[model samples]
Target: MLATPRPRSTFSNAQIAAYFYSPCRNQYDEPVPEYFRCRCWKIRKQTSRNGFTNLMQHVRSEHPTFQEEMLAATTAQTSSVAH
Candidate 1:
């Protein structure tokens, strides 16, 4: 079987920083890599959680423009693969 290439991040660092981060810091004063928090305006800033679920939900609910961007990108990839 052929190995599929790994995908890169679709959004830029600035775009990513606008919505999410891992707030907890270690002894070295660096953010922990495993945990993440959603920083959407519509919802209260919550406890930093794990995974993309919270971030995606924030995008879908609080940020329509971004959600559309994500859908468009995914749709393009899907159509390309189907051809």
Candidate 2:
């Protein structure tokens, strides 16, 4: 039997890292970080968390503008590649 294919991520690691800074790093960029800084909170410190589910939920709720921009960029890149 054929193995099931995993769905590709809508957000790339570089894009995600640029928008949300990750704490953990290594020799190479292949390994994803364990935590990401939140863009919200106008205080002395920012929030951080592990896993994409939390990060995605935070983006969907707190950063609609960023989300829209990412979507637009992704769409443009895909269209350009198709042509």
Candidate 3:
């Protein structure tokens, strides 16, 4: 008997990460570290291992607009909920 084709999944098919980051696979198409070729500064900086310290620093130092907007939004949200 001939094999039948399988149906594609309807759920968990969306990947938001695919938009922000580039392909991080190795020679064998395997997953790599989270901080690979990270553009945390003017030039891409590669970390020895996976961590969020660099990313946090990048947001705090590189994106002043983001910082101000985030602070304002956070203050508004918190003050609304405050007693």
- Model 2 scores a TM of 0.36
Overall local distance difference test of candidate 1: 0.48
Task: Give model 1's clash tally.
Answer: 0
The per-candidate count of clashes, in order, stands at 0, 0, 0
Q: List the global CA lDDT of all models.
A: 0.48, 0.49, 0.37
Clashing pairs in 3: none
Candidate 3 off by > 4 Å: 1-30, 36-50, 67-83
Q: How displaced is residue 62 in candidate 2, in Å?
A: 0.6
- TM-score for each prediction? 0.31, 0.36, 0.30
Evaluate model 3: give its lDDT.
0.37
Model 3 / residue 73 / CA error / Å = 12
lDDT of 2: 0.49
List ranges where model 1 is wrong by over 4 Å: 1-28, 37-50, 67-83
lDDT of 1 by residue, 1-83 (tens): 99987345556433443434445556998976544455443332333463355555565456656534544654343233321
Q: Give RMSD (Å) of candidate 3 vs. truth.
A: 17.6
Q: 1-83, model 2: which lDDT tens digit per residue?
A: 99988456466534553554445435785544454455463111223444355566565556656545656665454333421
